[model samples]
Target: MGDRRALETQLAVVAGFENPQARLEQYPTPPDIAAHVVHFADLQGDVDGRTVVDLGTGTGMLALGAALRGPRRVVGVELDAAALDTARDNERRVGTTTPIHWIRGDATRSPLCVHSDGNSETTVLMNPPFGAQNGRRGADRGFLRTASELADVSYSIHNQGSRQFVESFAADEGGEVTHAFGATLTLDRQFDFHEQETRDLDTEVFRIRWT
Candidate 1:
């Protein structure tokens, strides 16, 4: 293992975070950073009293941040049992009264209506796998399709190159990008996987609105 990888595992240990598992690579964004994203992006939840569903909400960082920012409800959908447990644990640890719910479910197949109130609009924030390998295409496609079905607006994180990767889906779903921005990521050692020690983690944050 690279020194960076070793260092990362150590950090995750110190922070009481789980080791990187399949499709759980992003871990949890630190609270400060998560708050920054919510504030800077101006992503507040339903004022009419509804919820924002966070797909792929590993460790519930995004969901918790939304709660802190005064969402009516913050719901996180995660498939990984370990990640789900960690999220639930964190919610308790924080002792938040914000009505945060962590559901053990697949993000790609979830019904959007199930996660939000009928009167309130829905927004989804997620960081899903890039599907850079050949075998993971099924997972990627299913996730996108499910996301399209579930939310009014979805903000998903992808490698900046994903702009091209998901282009074909626009035709399939009759969807268009409402907004997108490129952001650079600074990673922890756990983020160092495969061969590279330090990769320039550039991402496109897309707002895909359902018509």
Candidate 2:
């Protein structure tokens, strides 16, 4: 599942193969990206066979990681077509019996937000926009609103740069940070392009539940 060539192709797809990578144009998450997965999985407490949702699931990194945790079903919702393609590919290449549903839509506008299919024991793991530069494009306050009504529990990702917004937004979402950790501790996990010496940045992994 962790094939090198497959991951390489995914990276190329994320980089737009032909276009230059720019924060202003397309903001793809770093390679491997294990911290968010760990954070969410931790907040999940004990999924066992519960359903899980992964928002802004680019390349299916977090979604796939959570799937390995034995969720009955895992859905990865992403807005980018390229990212969706890679996500589906990763599910096929890496392998998983945990049903994977990859939806093509922005995290803020979840197509399944209205679902009432009895998967109430659901958990969501999200890595949303940074609220920097064009970060608000397709990502805004609405995302938190949607999540509150959609899942019983969630783990949302935000950088120190957006502390004020995250704090306020979490309050509005009826959720709060159950655990906060430096990205440095997170970078300690497995990754494609992320490892020690990557960054000393700070990010919060908020375990949001009925605030």
Candidate 3:
């Protein structure tokens, strides 16, 4: 119903993880970036009346954005119970009429079944871990895999310099990268290891069509 700025304003109320895990790389997706992705998807005709899934949906930023955009239903999968709790709270704060199902499970190995015939088309939205943490390389790979298995299309955000990896993965999985763009992820230092009060991360977003 609103423009991207309006969506970003709505999502600004979403809460981040109360106790973020370093291993999970649990930084919240910025409201502006979430708005950008959601609005782009909406313009592409992928959101309204679709079954939108947000994998690793920490605090429901992307999921809530989709919910506000008139998705028929939304499913948010996260492994942390506490994050899911916050997501529920954020859902209320966003005040969207769309129904959202928040599930507690690993997004990499999602618990959702593939859509059956006559079911609404599935579209996935995620800001998965960038695998920048120690011993956590290739973290976003699993998210992509899950999207391939469950969605007709997916929009994902990843660390910069990921185009090659993402393109390769999509080709191998029988998916095609239809849209690519760059964005800035601004993070206020939440964890102890951060050297600055705020950090601006260069990031990329990809829209993939899964066969």
For lDDT, the strongest prediction is: 3
Kindly list the per-residue Cα lDDT of model 3 for residues 1-211, writing each as its tens digit: 5799999999999999999999999999999999999999999999988999999999999999999998889999999999999999998888888989999999998999959247479999999999999888999999999999999999999999999999999999999999999999999998888999999999999999999
Q: Residue 12 error for model 3, in Å? A: 1.0
lDDT pick, better of 1 and 3? 3
Once model 3 is optimally superposed onto the true structure by TM-score, how far is the C-alpha of residue 73 displaced, in angstroms?
A: 0.2
lDDT of 2 by residue, 55-153 (tens): 777777667766666677788887777667867877776566788999998677778853435553777776666655455543545666667777776
RMSD of candidates 1 onward, in order: 7.1, 6.7, 1.0
Q: Candidate 1 residues 1-211, lDDT tens each?
A: 1132322232232132576664445545544445444543344332124466888887876676555555567789887887788888877765557887788887877744654445666666676777765566545566677777766666677777777656667456867776677767655556445566544577777767665
Error of 3 at 1 (Å): 4.4
Could you give me the TM-score of model 3 versus the true structure?
0.98
By TM-score rank, best first, the candidates go 3, 1, 2
Clashing residue pairs, candidate 3? none
Q: Which whole-number lDDT from 0 to 100 does residue 184 have in model 2?
A: 29
| Higher-ranked by lDDT: 1 or 2 | 1
**Model 2 weakest 10-residue run by lDDT:** 12-21
| TM value for model 2 | 0.70
Cα lDDT computed for each candidate against the true fold: 0.62, 0.60, 0.94
